[model samples]
Target: MDRLIQILKDPLLIAALAILVLLGAGELLSPGFARGDQIVRLLTVAAILGIVAAGQNLVVLGGREGIDLSVGAVISLGAVIAGNVMSGNDAAILPAVAAAAGAGFLVGIVNGLGVTVVRIPPLVMTLGMMGVLQGALVVLSRGVPSGNAAPALMAFVNQPFVLGIPGILFVWAAIAVLMAFVLRRTAFGWSIYAIGSNERAAVLTGLAAGRIRTILYGLSGLFAGVTGVCVIGYTGNSFISVGDQYVLPSVIAVVIGGTSLAGGSGSYTGTILGAIALVLLQSVLTTLQMEFWSRQVIFGATLLVLMLLYGRQARLRV
Candidate 1:
């Protein structure tokens, strides 16, 4: 009984259970809610969001009000560049994807420099960066992005392998495993947590807090870049505002996964489940044929309630 209670008390497990319950309820309202194929499809969509949230998770763990507001813009820019560069050609795929990721890395470096060297607050710096990317994308694309998603890119992301699991799922799993190992078993990861938990103390103890933070931001940007390519693949095209839908949801997923907004503590495992839950929520909403505005309201309200619940839980644990 004690073990069961402890399991129930775990926020990540609770979130997963909630997803199951919602699926059950959805099944009652609509048949085939939990069909195997549907679940796979749902997970595939969630995997993209999860990939983006992974980066956000790292930044949150970097502490000092660390948050990457430019992710959506980065995604947009990456997709635009990839689309233009690839032009639907299989031959151009690798180089185009590489270019997109490289651009994202550059953006990440700039963001890191702004926060670490210029001493700007993360929120302000990233927001300014977001606006800059958005404007720059407009100028570069001249308002309309050309070219379709490369066939090769789409096929690779959508490919099925190893007992019918999606290639994208494998990609997400690899990233999740890598991040979990880094956070749990690495000196750098330890420094990240230490700095986030207490920056002054960490610095005094000889942790390179600034360098770690810069690296975290760079990783976040890299993930955003990959997410952009996924978005383009899924949609078969790129356009302005292509990634705007992800910004808030990525944050929500991280928070719902039990990552403290104040930073210092989080888990990629929790975030994976959180991403699943959010995607399931979207499926439920869509099943009900809810309007877009209603979905947004519910999303916001749900996030608030989850925050309150977890906040109270944290206090009780303390």
Candidate 2:
């Protein structure tokens, strides 16, 4: 019993448990909840959140007050740009895709530069970038996003089929697995923890703290671009604030999964679990016919509760 309580105290374990509980309850409450198609649809949504969670995990795990506030803006801008660049040509889609990705990278670099070179706090740097990027989008799109993405690109993302499993589910799962490997198995992975644990100490010990911070932001940008692309595939078009909705959800998912906001600790598995739990929570609430505002209220309450629990842990020394 004591051991179980201790395990529950661990963020990753708690997140996983939340996933199981929510998922099981969802299955019990909904008709055909376990059906492959329904499960796939739920996973499709979860994947979108998970992809963004992966990037947020990097910023959070990188420490030194690192966080990516511009992720939503970056994604929105990327999708809008991709929409314009594709302009109904399947072949042309790749170039615009590259441009969209490049746009995200640039934003991330700006974030890193602001934090490291300009000495702005991460929050302020990203908040400023978010507004700047949104303004840039309006300018680039000429007040309206007129272009359409290629048909093939849209079909690929929306259609779900890969060895009898939904393509989107498998795609996101594959991404999560690959990321898990990278973080757990690679040398650069070590630098994430080292830098987060003690930026000055890491710098003294030979890790390029600034360079790595910059690169992590770049990685965050790169991931944001991928998410934007996937979303375009899912929605077949772009709106200015479409990608912005993901910002809070992404951060919340990563944090709920047990990745410390203070950094130097976390796992992709936890993030994945957290994403799943969030999706299941939404699914169950929708099934229950909860009002939109009420759902938001409940979400706020849940977050408050989690914060209280987490705060207690943060204040403890064990």
Candidate 3:
């Protein structure tokens, strides 16, 4: 009983329980909502969010009010870049991916510089970066149709690859493992936590807190870019607004997964479960035939409640 209680005390475990409850509610309401195929589909969607949230997790973990509001813009631009580079050709997929990742990385580096060097607040820096990227997208796209995703790429993302799981899920799983190792077993990861937990102390202890936080922002951009490529694969096309919907949800997933907004402590594993729970909640809401605006209201309420609960604790820690 004690062991069980201990497990239940863990936020990750709590998130998992929430996922199961959401699943149950979804199944009860929609009958086939929890069926194998349906669950797989939902997991696939969650994988994309999870990937984006991975970057968000890193930024939040790096502390000092770290966040990458430009992620959505980065994703949108990455998709546009990938689609144009690929031009519906399977052979061009690799090049397209490289272009997207590279572009996103450059953008992220700029964001990092603005935050660390220019002394801009993270929220302001990233938000401004988001606007810049959006404008760049407008100039590049010029109100024309975007390019199509290669059929092969689409298949890889949507079709079952191993044991009936989408290939994107495999990608997400690999990222999760890599993230776990980096956070648990790396000096860089330790520095992130230290800096986030107490930046002044970490700086005094010889950690280059600014540099590490900058890298965190860069990685966030990289992940957002990758998500953009994946988004095109899943949708078979690209648009300027393809990534607009992910920004808030990515933050929500990170927080829901138990990552403190104040930074210094959290795990990608929790974010993964949080992503799943969020997807399930959305699915359940959709099943109930809720209007789009109404669903947004619910999401807003959820975020508000989570902030009150988690944010309070985080503030106390500081």
Top model number, lDDT: 3
Q: Estimate each model's TM-score.
A: 0.93, 0.91, 0.96
| Model 3 agreement with the true structure over 1-318: per-residue lDDT tens digits | 999988776778878999999989998897889999999999999999999899999998988778899999999999999999999999999999999988888888888888899989999999999998888888889856598899999999999998999899999999999999999999988888899888888989999877998889889999999999999999988988789889988998998888888889888998999899989989899999999888888888888887776642536222
Q: Point out the higher-scoring one by lDDT: 1 or 3.
A: 3
Order of models, best TM-score first: 3, 1, 2
lDDT by residue (1-318, candidate 1, tens digit) is: 999988887878887897889889778888998888888888889999999999999998888778899999999988888888888998987887788888888899899989999999899999999999989888877888656788877876776656877778888999999999999999988988888777888999998888999999998998999898888887889997898888888888888788876678788888998899999998899988999889899888977887786622242111
Residue pairs that clash (backbone atoms under 3 angstroms), model 3? none
lDDT of every predicted structure (CA atoms): 0.86, 0.80, 0.89
Better of 1 and 3 by TM-score: 3
Which 10-residue window in model 2 sums to the lowest lDDT? 309-318
